[model samples]
Target: MNPLLPIRHFVPDTEARVMPDGRLYLYGSYDISRETTYCSDILHVFSTDDLVHWTDHGAALRSQDIPWASEGHLLYAPDCIYQDGTYYLYFCMTGSYEGVAISDSPAGPFHHPVPITPADRDSIDPAVFIDTDGQAYYFWGQFHLRGSKLNPDMITLDVSTLNTCIIDEKNHGFHEGISIRKRNGIYYLLYTDISRGKATCISYAMSDSPLGPYKKGGVIIDNINCDPNTWNNHGCMAEYKGQWYVFYHRSSQNSKFNRRVCIEPIFFDERGYIAEVPMTSQGAEPPLSAGVPISAALACQMMHGLFISPAADNTTEILSHATNGSWAAYRYLSFDAPKSFSITAAAAINGGTVEIWADSLLLGSCLVTPTGGWDIYRTFRCPLTPVTGVKTLYLVFRGNDLKRRLMDVKEFCFYGDCGSGNAD
Candidate 1:
């Protein structure tokens, strides 16, 4: 589903690359579940041959390993590139200081990290792109986009080639998180656009030169409804199997600190302008099957106090602190003759009702009776109204107490004709 990693792992600001091993690698900053601000000290990488199945290569880098970095566990965002025989991991720490580390593998316990020079104190989010002629370019900064050629060492910047103010931040909606790629002789610059009064959108621009006066293309996706307090989106576009996809993240646990990686396929027009994509519960995965249980954590859109919180097990998540009129939506579920709707919930409040609607079709409604505590759960099912097509499912909750948490919800499934995994 949408949150690409486990509920326990909050990895954000992802940079994706299709490495030599024929697998796509994702490198990002890790967020400790309890933190209220941003990222933690450690970084994690995930790789996948198929977009649906991912392998977490844990702890690629740690703050403890970097002597120059501060002790406050504030590693923010990272990017990794494979050059020659070594994988270069680029990271930014609390003081906006940027550095590079090396490992033999794409997913690595990267070692011997060193901070870079020619990087301004306000630098963050280092992106590396190699051109068709085998020359590598490095990009970093906050509001102002900066670029330069990487030295043969792959760590040092070619100072003579430094280019600054490549994009007008205030005019082009540039906030941060610049990732670059080239296709068909056109350079694509993807960044977190400063629209919606915040950096919640991943937008792009196009240019003929590597560093230039680029033209703003359009937004790729927005991280709206990922969290009530969700503020930013940072990721990059990657091509796999001749298909293009945008990798981004969403916040969880009702807080902006606990963010998770998510992705969706993107389309390009004849002119190569990317069409805007909305957030989806299905993500890059297939339409959700009506047969098996779908985790409540897969919800891409949440409203009010409702959120996906980490469970006691730390592996699963619960739909928590749902107030009256609070709701969450799971996108694009394939329902083939669904007979009954089922829910697993634990309620402390007495008079709460869950009105299940399949994109306004009104499947059914069921009472969420108290199950003693938030940790406790029980399954409840109601007959569906013969739902049979792919639709977005909405769990519109109602209760007398407008601000009180009604129940904690978990996995839910439908009883019907269906198969396993993706649709056939």
Candidate 2:
């Protein structure tokens, strides 16, 4: 079976919530008008039984009625939670502050927006978590992190326990895209740290109480197979068939416009802490699945590369590229028939190209282009020529102007055969 065949496309800026009935509902922002690109509105009610296919229920919310937002400003990064027979949708308007809408049904003609918290403070990406003790807490912030207690109704803040600083330290504040999950009596607060760039690192804080003096932990997820300068944040975690996974987005090859969702496995340590997730590009061994066709999101996670860029001094670092930028490879297996290979790239240089060679025979090259937005995803394919002996595939990024940055590759796939080879 083709590896890429199983991946399904999802609308951008979408967050998912699973109903008690086992149906998955998605809420997100939609780019309705092409003129400004930012003229996006909130789209509600998309559902899927299996992750591979999705059904759209049309716009559940739109910009036509929002009085506080300007015409061109779009709604973004919506999150939802169900409580007391009501689904509360929390979303950011104009990328400034978060508001909420209430609906009786999962797919809703939601009520008009109501401010959960005042807009005087900078806030976005509000995630509401109901802890084991049945207390609701709100977490949000872009550059500065903040959290607070929510009323039992989950619509407005309690105010009695007003805003609390979970991790408000300067240079350490990354309060966007937050999710709180409790496993085995330990509460894990998962959030994205964007100080590193468009590349988001997933870190967690653990505590005995939902609203806490939580202790911060190491990074659980970091960029793999994409540029650190590219955006890859805002995701949700889910468990399917007993495996824990995270669904998140990454900026396409161009590093700006196209953002695609990918999935990766989440592992836990013996002490219940998450293990250090290896960067993509250091190709991982195929997920154990009895060889069934897995979703492209999962496959992409398994084969993502590491983000390598010019250091602060603008000096290029020549490290062997690994799958997800962590695992070194001496051999690779193909996913398609005819033994093919491909490399896709986006960069800011002229006359720059990436060359792929196997056993001294040229396999393929992808030319860099500027017209392609800094966030374009491009794929170049090359058919592998049959050879009787050993084969070694090598990749090199070459550019005429050293000052011009090279390309950031998400990851490449080899198909058809596992030729005998070894890395020297």
Best by lDDT: 1
Off by over 4 Å in 2: 1-14, 30-39, 119-122, 169-175, 195-199, 224-229, 278-424
Span of ten consecutive residues with least summed lDDT in model 1? 415-424
Provide the overall lDDT of each model, using Cα atoms, as 2-decimal numbers: 0.85, 0.54
Give lDDT tens digits, candidate 1, residues 1-424.
7888766678899988999999999899888886887898788889998887889888898888988776775777888888889999988888887888899999999999998777735588889898988899999988989999999898888988888888857878889999998877889999999867878999999999887769999899998887888889999999999989899998887788888889899998889899999899888878988778888877889887788888878777778877889888999899887778778887765638888899988888877678777777777767888878899999988988877788878877888422122211
Which pairs, if any, clash in model 1? none
Q: How far off is residue 202 in model 2, in Å?
A: 2.2
Per-model TM against the reference: 0.94, 0.66
List the candidate 1 regions with Cα displacement exceeding 4 Å. Answer: 416-424
lDDT of 2 by residue, 1-424 (tens): 1111112222444565778778777665543311224325656567766554666676777765566666755676777888888888887777585678888878887777777765323667677777766788877766555677888767777666655566643545354667777778887777776555543676777888776667776677665444423454666665554566655555432233344444556888878788755433212234222112211222222223433322223222222122211222222223222245554444433425556555466656545444254444355555654333333334556666554445554445555222122210
Write down the RMSD of candidate 2 (Cα, Å).
9.2
